[model samples]
Target: MRIRTAGVVAVLGLALAASGCGDNSKDEPAAKDSPKAASGKLVIWADDKRAAALKPFGEKFGQENGVTVEVQAVSKDLQTNFVTASQQGSGPDVVVGAHDWIGNLVQNGAIDPVQLAAEQKSAFNETAVKAVTFNGQVYGVPYATENIALIRNTELAPEAPKTIEDLVASGKKLKAEKKASEILCLQSGQNGDAYHIYPLYTSAGGYLFGTAANGDYDPKDLGVGKPESIAAFQKIAKLGEKGDGALKRSITGENSIATFTGKKCAYLVSGPWAIADAKKAGIKYDISPVPGFAGGKEAQPFVGVQSFYVAAKGKNKALAQEFVTNYVTKPDLAVALYNAEPRPPALTAAFDQVKGTDPDLAKFSEAGKNGQVLPAIPAMAAIWDPFGKAEAAVIGGADPTKTVTAAGKTISGQIK
Candidate 1:
């Protein structure tokens, strides 16, 4: 449950490294000509965290299908290694990863579109399905979802704020009364986190990319330089250093959860991943949707999905499809995965089974019902650094207009 923002470099660097692996030849039939289900064995790759959880299921599936199943833990550089190995025709039949990797994996010819029945697709959360869909094709079978919401200390702030303005007012009062040392525990750091700050940014009327006719992000219609974005920054500047001082470069991913759990802040904009620390600290807390600016759009966090993709160059294509499309969709498997890593389950039946006992899942899912799926387009690789720097600079008292405009220009030039 590491912060997604901190791993941007490693993820993007791996993607860059993948470009040097040379594209898979469209004419080559190495994998396509392989013995489909006749291989008598199926291999799956997963990170260390989930590999153990998958082993028993793999064994069961293998026994049922009359084949040997292996779930290998490719902990280091899983995605990068998957791609490189895939290109050499020696990768696993299935690989587990984030939905955001769909575009790069598809572009590299490392994974294939998953075929799920219409009823099967309807069994999962709509947002989860959308996150795994790229260019009208579903590339993965989603299992769990994560999104940031407003986690408030109930002892410090008994009621949820109706708007960002109300939250700020309450935070200021808490600071004045010496109940808290910070306003909001949204992580900014020296290098700003677009992920943590995104809900507020959207509420202030900013967007990353405009939607195309297909309802997918249109890289050509960059939103950063537009008029609405500038207007959004004008609102954001009011929450920066010279203003209400809620957002700060001093607060970071490393400390924001700790600050909240330590009762140093009343409100924390974070995901379910932070719940463990809060519980360990023995704090009375409640979760809610991040409030919007009084008159602006509803706050929308990016919905990230964890999924299983069938590798295109797999040795056992039929077995891979069977495991991913059928076995992984079971409620028991989804619940088991959730137990291993406590994110909300993407499967509706599994979530229903668990929500009665764990009400927090319902709250987090409610907060993200309107959230946009984290865009998986390859152009998104160009966004992180410039955009984060501009945000960090603005929060540190730099001119919002000049800084944001420059960032937009730099990003546009980099999006190929």
Candidate 2:
């Protein structure tokens, strides 16, 4: 899929600033509403794409609710701007973003919990809704859900492969015959994409953290270095018999979408974002389940939930809540948003509404039915750097068990 360059750059900047040093102590307390304060205006911070799609809706909501809705398109640094603005007592009343940002946002005390009506709660995928729920409180109203699925060039592989062995064998033959460049292409940048790689790990009976009695992730049970995880990595490392090693992030070049659409790869682990470009390239493609590894369970990727969150500190909490709960939650708007971006809908009605028209989305929805939500706990922040390095080491020919074990230990130690 085509990368939203501006969004990526903005998110990267926020991620960098959030990951590095920051003045947490300087954050201002959330403004408390006095009994007399007016609540006639609501400000919203949204990405350019979402802003363009939702601006009219926002205006309509404002008119219906007798409130002025100010929708600002903040291309990047959402978390940074939200945090900094909240601290300065000048931030939007609501923001649209991924659930993964919960930990950082909560740490900065930049957002508040959202209380959904029973009917509203029932409308969303339970797992998607739960991703934004932290420490026993719901924090966001989910709009969409996304997950990685195994995508193959339909013309090359008319039928989907059922197992890892089947994929490997077919990919090998195609490469040998000069019909394809690589068997599969997965993301492997400076920080290996744990989110994207989760399917392989789960296919081998591996997980990043264990679940508690309540089904929330248990921070103490970090599983990055488990034997199963190692085995999964080992299998992935063996895929592209390139003497060099498993896929490297640097080799992926500037655009991964180009790599797949260019017909250099037969199978790619991607999401809806790539569908538009694949259509542009005139490549016949379809999605399928990720292959299971070593006789383990089916591969399940991390399901990412995108939602709207009202800042606890927002100047227009009442108006923001009314817009989200009353207007944005409707099936029509949800369908519109899903159509614009083409990801599975978190809203159940929206899912049923758009499934027939968008085959790619249907494929993703089916593939992710058994998927797990990526961990949103604060400890998860520690997994990226060291875990990626260990995966790199294994791909670089280091001992699988040792590399993963060391990485796991380092990750466990780093988490507070």
Candidate 3:
């Protein structure tokens, strides 16, 4: 979950990128049409990563329902496009996307609540179901989950760093020995990465939003500028170039993979997405929870679940609901999706099938054992810009207290 929303513009950045694609109208359906227009058809939009895996399942569902089922890859701006298409009544009947889209999709009236039987819901990871629920309504069927963890070059460090200070000390030694060029591979280029830095902030007692009575995130309780947040960043600032030189804005997402793969860094704070590249680079790595500061709490990453949702505006409402809550919830389908991307599956059966088979997967789950469910509230849309900029300033040698305080005010004002 670390840096999951890095560099996002509003809540529209990298976090939702997995929801699907399309940059312009040429790619988007120009007019919304009811799924009713094609009375016997069903469609699902997904990011390219899941399209191939879903095609066979779509064929099976179509065969059973006697309706055509197409799993389309929207590869660009899935969240915005789906809603845009929905307003015009032309969106797909179903969409495979990130759970956090629930709030925005509901706000746009693009999705309907999914009715999962208690027995069926009981088969999923509790955190996953919670991620797709909004205001007490289950809006999506979760299939897979992901969160960032510490991917360390074992040959270099051999053991996981006990604390943030220890990690920095080890990194500095590696740099001094000319064994690496960078201290760490956690990206912070320019705007800074709030997602990646969240654990540190939290370990220092910072929080993004307060919890509502029902355990949902309350945007009204903005914490970006609170005293704890400032103290957290002050600690982070001490690790930057002017201080320990453990972090730098130059290590961006675009370069992080290469930095770690090239042996330019000993540890990379990243998600499962980088595993393949590390293998290709032949780097012997280990996965563990990202360590926290010495005096802080245990590090916690943000938990994100990828899910399937039914479009409220679709013509095949009944069939769409049937596909999402019934068909997509199966353990086999969940495992297939996991095989395609290697993220931990959300289905309890599927998770049990894979956990013992892959130590890496188990490690990620362990790392996020007490992670924050990436808040799905609409107010998250207003937090990215100001908070990210403030983090950038602090990392670049600015005052943590002033920068974090100003960011909190900006977020509160925007929420109001």
Candidate 4:
């Protein structure tokens, strides 16, 4: 993938930060214990991308405050590692994670509620904050947000389809001319991806969880097998059957991007991460909201937010709060982060800065304007497995309604 100029600048900033930063690992003497220092050390665990980006900031913060900052890039399982490390009193002072993981993190007592200043609160996306809120308490600071939208290869279809019928018709045209493999490309592995497929379900007016008085997801009101979900699945099943079941278990994020960029498919439902590759392949594309099904509502994908959370068990809570609230939340930092990664910014001002620069991001923001935040309730852990199986059943030729209904019952029972 060809890296954009903005992306290059972001990477350079991160590289500079990583090299200039001081070691703040536990192995080092506590800065406070050193007579010349002002405070203590702060440890942070982040994914590789974030870790690289934050290294320079860490070095700067450490130097400015006389407190050392340690950054470790843990690639595999953040949640599992956080839980295990916290129990051993060796976890990070702060963690970078997703909002949906709030439920489990809170339940496990692995994170603490963050108390943002009123001004700080105003600077963030309310919906992003709400995603990390559980039982009336806020737990994380969101840095970025994401959602899927319809991305069409302009070479194959110059204009984006406004409805499922339009998408299907375009697909049929491509197939007739042997220009495409299928009308719509979706992932349907044994464990189906309900998150990515959510737009299709919502387009049919189905929802996985109902809302409460406060708009929090009501776990008891499971809607997996709702008539709308079934209808939506049936529509996709019909397309799968007619197209030789091209939407198979093997189809993944990588493959989906390939299909569109390779010009083998006209429309792909994806997020901003695919932009670099799409551009590099020299394929012209435009994004739009996922179209609604017949007699159904507009397709609304689940909105996801990437956030930072203070560790309740951290030894340096005050310093961690200072870093997140004072430094990371600034417009300059926010803009740098967004430009580096190109997801929707949680801060409105920062978001507005680059909103016009990236068309893909703008389309995603539009698509998510009416989208529901993915349920962060702990019960969501039980929904993914069974619901995915039901989607697989539909793709495998079983009745959509029956499969989804069974899956819903199983999920509800497990939660109970």
Candidate 5:
């Protein structure tokens, strides 16, 4: 499988979403292709955003090591592409992708664990390091971290919603005044969207999996079918169209941002990715935690980290390790990647440097301050479609108990 450029990445991006918890680990049978190895050289694959900034460092590494270093752009479906290529013994020495890719990558034997010193690990945000660490080893060197947060229109609701109820109440009043067409742009589509709804789910006491004693996700501890999940979705159902009409199926993933940008909604539960559109639409917005249910637990969004992994089957394994462990771990590279992508830098020094220049990054970092590290275990893949459909069904007025209960069964079957 050949890797494509940034302009055509949707398919690769959907690979993981199609398969499980992310775009990086999308489900596909492994395909073996010939290795594209260049003699006496080191190759690194990454998205376009980081390639340019990484070039100089790659060259510097080559100069010091007396080897040619190629920084290739594998802008599309990087994680899946890397995996498939690895199967054929034909992937780059290093691959840059989301931290969540660890589970599937490790399962496919595509990436080698990156060994970082204690201080080296401490140099990064703990969450980034944790996301890259699966089981007992770290497989990637993280550069940045990101998560969703509430983006509210300042003019429509000056103060941040203290709770999810406050957000809904304010929206309903605005709806009554004909000032807004929707209550909120949370976007539960026809089939449901677990990602967008996770804050509310967790706030109402839902969890996907519990951590092992070692602090890694324990696949055996499934949370979807448990009573806590049922209780959580029951609360989620109340906000659906069948009950308070706060969460409408009409507010789909495609339209939520548009709806918010058009001023049809006072609040939008989204990530930093949505900020550009808000700025373009000239909406007066402020970032905050996705408010929880009134008097309930604090809302928690899933935290994601973007990092560099050394491909286990690369042509040059030792060089791959050197590149990831020594070259990619720098604070400047972290800052450079952040400039290209604008997520929170994982390295403390980079984060400190950027936070002074970009307050929005700081705001978002705080928004996900207490957020849960999104589970990267293979079991996590099973929860997406089943849970999404169930949530959508509940939002559309189906019995939350029956719908969520059935969805839990589906997930259990897959994981089993």
Candidate 6:
């Protein structure tokens, strides 16, 4: 992916809904194309918005297949509930959720590998496909991709900063001029947010896990507690409360976008989901890559893919496979989903059509060119809380080296 030289003129809005928890351990079973009658009922579960968007498509598909299609809206705990219901042999044939849930879904035998032809697989964003793949098998059909970018108010800071140092300098100037109340709106709450802070962490040379030869994260090769991670934390300390005072526990995920939309800050490190509020606030803004450290590596955010999975133990496996493998791959369906939620389409064809109207999709895609796919390995569950708390402590003035080292140990223990 290349970062194109594009100016953000008309901004588009997006909202990334709830991402739930799941993990994978054993190899997922392959989806077999069983020859069966298509007249049976096909039930699908999704969050409210997606359910609403899919109803029309589902009805059309049902009519074409001579079947009944029910798109149920599970407002809360969709992933956990799907898992529980699948285990009891009572879940829907299809479930829409984040790709990160592939691990646990596979581990619990709640979802099956989604069979896609080579051309179909290649039709979507490469990173989106990679996110839904587990143990070398594609497990879901991805619809949208999301990652954080540097969203700056053009009215407050006309030019995009090249690096973290440059951003800090510009923000400091804005604050000193009494034009802005805060320097940056990157969130680091009391418990920390590893997801939102990942760009900065990587820019400072910190890594979560080492990758294997297959390009999969190696759970055994934890990068925390290492010399490089210690060095990275030390660098981050300079931006903490004890240093530049830019990162604050008060700036949370719930409020970071508001801070920027409210014009209290010049810059916000956020994803496409925040764009809706930003557009509503009527701020003249532009999107760019989250700048890296002065001499460090490029800042890489976590790329999250939203996907649809086939329940492993659903009553209508044949119908489910037909819907997920064939019906869901259509560019029109992808375009419709985008219209419902306005995320960057994972399908290349759909994205191509949408980019002409929603140029912010192109800008966001450029911003996340160097992004790392959010890991879906079961071991990843162990890294969140411990790592987040350690990050919070360091941001609140704890010893960077000691605190990070302890976090690494805690994560290691949990993984073990």
TM-scores vs. true structure, each candidate: 0.90, 0.87, 0.90, 0.87, 0.89, 0.91
Per-residue error (Å), model 5, residue 392: 0.8
Model 2: lDDT of residue 17:
11
> Residue by residue across 292-348, what tens digits does model 1's lDDT show?
899999999999999999999998886687778767988999999898888999999
lDDT head-to-head 3 vs 6, winner: 6
Better of 4 and 5 by TM-score: 5
Q: What is the lDDT of residue 30 in candidate 2?
A: 19
Q: For model 6, how does the per-residue alpha-carbon lDDT over 1-416 read when each residue is reduced to its tens digit?
A: 11121111121121211221112213432233332433367788988888878988887766665566788888888888999899888788899999989888999999988867776777889999999989999999999998889999999999999999999999999999999999999998889999988888999899999999999999999998988888888888899899897888889988889999999999999988888999999999999999999999999999999999989988888678878877788889999999988889999999999999997898899989789999999899998898889888998999988999999999999999
Give the alpha carbon lDDT tens digit for every residue of 189-227 in model 5: 888888889989999999999888888888888889899
Cα error of candidate 2 at position 131, Å: 1.9
Candidate 2 accuracy as TM-score: 0.87
Worst 10 residues of 6 by lDDT: 1-10
**Which of candidates 3 and 4 reaches a greater TM-score?**
3
Tell me which of candidates 2 and 3 scores higher on lDDT: 3
lDDT of 3 by residue, 1-416 (tens): 01111111111111111111112244212112212224576778887768878878887766554566667788788888889889998788888889888889999899988767666777899999899889988899899989999999999999999899999999999999999999998888898888888877788788899998999999878888888788888998998867888888888879998999999999999999999999999999999999999989888889999999989988888777767766777788998998899999999999998888778999998898799999999999888888888888888899988888888888888888
Candidate 5 residue spans exceeding 4 A from truth? 1-38
Per-model lDDT: 0.85, 0.74, 0.82, 0.76, 0.81, 0.85
lDDT of 4: 0.76
Q: With candidate 3 superimposed using the best TM-score fit, by how many Å does residue 181's alpha carbon deviate from the native?
A: 1.0
Ranking by lDDT, best first? 6, 1, 3, 5, 4, 2
Per-residue error for 188 in candidate 3, Å, reads: 1.0
Across residues 195-307, which tens digit of lDDT does each residue of candidate 4 receive?
A: 87788777767778898998888998888877867777877676554344545666775587887788878888788888888899998888888887767787888899998
lDDT of 2: 0.74
Query: Worst 10-residue stretch by lDDT in candidate 2?
Result: 8-17
